[model samples]
Target: MHAFVHEGNELIYKNLNDPVIEKGKVIIALRAAGLNHRDLNIPSRRGENSIPLVLGSDGAGVIEQVGEGVKELTIGDEVIINPGLGWEKNSDAPPKGFEILGMPDNGTFAEKIVIDAKQVEKKPDHLNWDEAGVLALPALTGYRTLFTKAQVKKGDTIFIPGAGSGVATYLIQFAKAAGAKVIVTSRSKEKLGKAKEIGADLAIDTHEDWESLLRNETIDIVIDSVGRATFNRSLSVLKKGGKMITFGSTTDDEITINIRQFFYGQYQLFGSTMGSTEEFKEMLDFISKHQIKPVVDHVFPLNNTQAAFDYLRAGKQFGKVAISINR
Candidate 1:
């Protein structure tokens, strides 16, 4: 088997021994894999003596082998891999021993990967391999953030900054499907236009004065992932008593807020990350019901995964970037 691995401060495409099937797990011959910003950070996180690890979180593939004690799944089932591990049900936060895929465990970057059968869900019929492959991690994050945390409802006005990310795109689609009025911001005019095409009611340039431009708009919820760079501006546009949910801090994490103003507004703020298994199932059902397909920005062959990482790092994508493995 071949995989893109992080070894001694660099990523290399190389051959690796095939993963052995374990009890309660299944080996999937991956057809496609999705690229996330975290994939670019893994190499830096590893120490000089760290072992080589496969690099991917989102994947879609066919079941090639089923291990003992796994009864619900069978060979040849097309499935999407859930990257979240150990948190089984909906909760305020992930439980202890929780972790994401693609790090300690071998992930979906290779032609074959062995994962717990519970982590595999049937791929929605409406999605192709690429769409299904890129759908799990980001979609789950968006679902938990918008519906579970914010409790967004019909007619609510939602503001999303940094509209070009995979999670942001899913947030736009999910909010719109639930009858919310969606607004997005991006420094790039091209990304703003794409957001409008995908159901955002308004797309604004990030450089603009957000408070002045949205003075009349009642932003019921602000879903922020860009963090320090856009946090204050996003909060300024929200109506009193509104909600603000954050899942990622792409720019910088630390930010100082006005404690008095925050308390005076009676605003609700929540932090979220990758969702639980129940939420992942609910998200699949939701997208299936809405017939929503993931927005795939580009597809690269498995061996060219380094290039895919480069594309994502340069902030050149408007949606999820994918890697074609067996396909």
Candidate 2:
């Protein structure tokens, strides 16, 4: 098997002995691996330690073998790897971090990888492997953030910042499906055009005073994945009693907000992260039923992962950048 290993802050593909599946686990022959900003940001624990640690989290593949005690999936079944394995499923369970497939351990950016059978789902027959690989994370996050955390409803006007990112692209489509009027903002004009193409009701230039442009309007929900750079503006554009749902901090993590402004507006601010397994399933089903597809900016061979990282680092992509493997 060939895998990209993190050998001291760099990614290198090298030969490895075949992975042995444990009881209740399944081994997948990966076809396409999705590359995300987090994939590029995973650091070696110690400066002297290896880097590029099998370097991907999201992937789609066909089952090669199932370990003893595995029953739900079998050989030759097409599936997508679910990266978030052990967050709480029960409402009563407290939020505790669980080991993810790629960052702290082996990931899917290889010829094959093994994981618990529950971590894999049957991929939609309508989508090819490359599309399924990138759709899970972004679509699940967007679906959960808007539908559950924010409780967005029909006719709601939701504003999303950093409209060109993978999550935002999916969010716009999902929001429209829910009958919400969608407003998007991005610094890049090209990305804004792309957003409109993908069904955003309106695209606002981040460079201009969008606040003034939106002064008289009241948005029902504001999804601010861009963080600090647009946090205050997100706060400014919300309707009284409306909610603000923020997920990622692509720009900067820290931001200062006026407590008085929140009180005066009676605003509700919520933070979301990657969703649970159930949410992932719901997102997959929604995509399947609605014929929604993720926007893939580009695809690179597994060996050219560095080029993929360079592309994402430039922050000019309209959506996701994927690395094809095992195909």
Candidate 3:
């Protein structure tokens, strides 16, 4: 099998031994894989002694070989891999053993992968191979953020900063489907326009004064991923006691906030990551119910995996960037 691997500070396309099926697992003939910001961080986290690792998180494929004890799935079934591992049911937090796919575990960047059957779900019928490939990670993150953590409800106004991400696009679609009013912010004018076309009721330029433009509106929830760069500004627009859910910190991890102001405002802040298996199922169902399709900005062939990573790192994508494997 050919895979995109990270070894000693470099990413290379190379051949690897095909994964063998294990009990309760299935070998998937990967059709497509998705790129995420996490994929960019994997190479930096590797130590000098670290083994070469396949890097990818989201993927859609067909079950080619189902191992012993796996009964619910069979060969030829089309499915998407749930990147989240260890955490099974819905809970306040993932278990201590929780880890995402890729990194320490070889992931879906290859033509084939073996994953626990429990991690594979039927690909939503409404989605194509590209859409299904990119759907799992971001959609699950957005679902848990909007529905579980923030408990967003109908008629509520939801504010999303960094609107160009895959998760942000999902948040917009999910929030709108739930009957909430959606507002998004993006530095790119083109992204702001795309956000509105998808379902955002309002799109604001990140360069403008956010608090000033939103003074008349009441934000019940703020879904943010920009981290230190936009954290304070995101809070400034939220109504008192509004919920703020964060899944990633693309800008910077460290940020100092005024404790007094935070407490005084009575805001609710929550941290979220890739969701559990149960939430993954719910996310799939939600998208299926709404007939929602993921926004795929570009697709690259398997051999061009490095270029896909470069495109994502440049922040040029409006939504998800996918790798076509079996295609």
* Every model: Cα RMSD to truth: 0.8, 1.7, 0.9
Q: Which portions of model 3 miss their true places by more than 4 Å?
A: none
Please provide TM-scores, in order, for all candidate models, with all chains considered together.
0.99, 0.96, 0.98
lDDT of 3 by residue, 1-327 (tens): 999999877898999999998999999999999999999988877855347899999999999999999989989999999999999999999999999999689988999999999999999888899999998899999999999999988899999998899999999999999999999999899999999999999999999999889999999999989999999999999998889889899988998899899999999999998888999999988999999999999999999999999899999899999999987
What lDDT score goes with residue 169 in model 1?
A: 95
The lDDT per prediction is 0.94, 0.84, 0.93
lDDT of 2 by residue, 1-327 (tens): 988777775567788778898999999999998888777777534344644467788899999999999888989999998888686472322266665568777887899998889889999888887888887777777888988798888998989988899999999999888888999998899999999999998899998787798886779999998889999988887888989988899878999989997898899988887888877888888888888888999999887877888899998899888889876
lDDT by residue (tens digit), candidate 1, 1-327: 999998877788999999999999999999999999988887877766357899899999999999999998999999999999999999999999998999888888999999999999999999999999999999999999999999999999999999999999999999999999999999999999999999999999999999989998999999999989999889989999999999999988999999899999999999999999999999999999999999999999999998898899999899999999986
By lDDT, the candidates rank as 1, 3, 2
Candidate 1 global CA lDDT score: 0.94
Model 2 TM-score is 0.96
Off by over 4 Å in 1: none
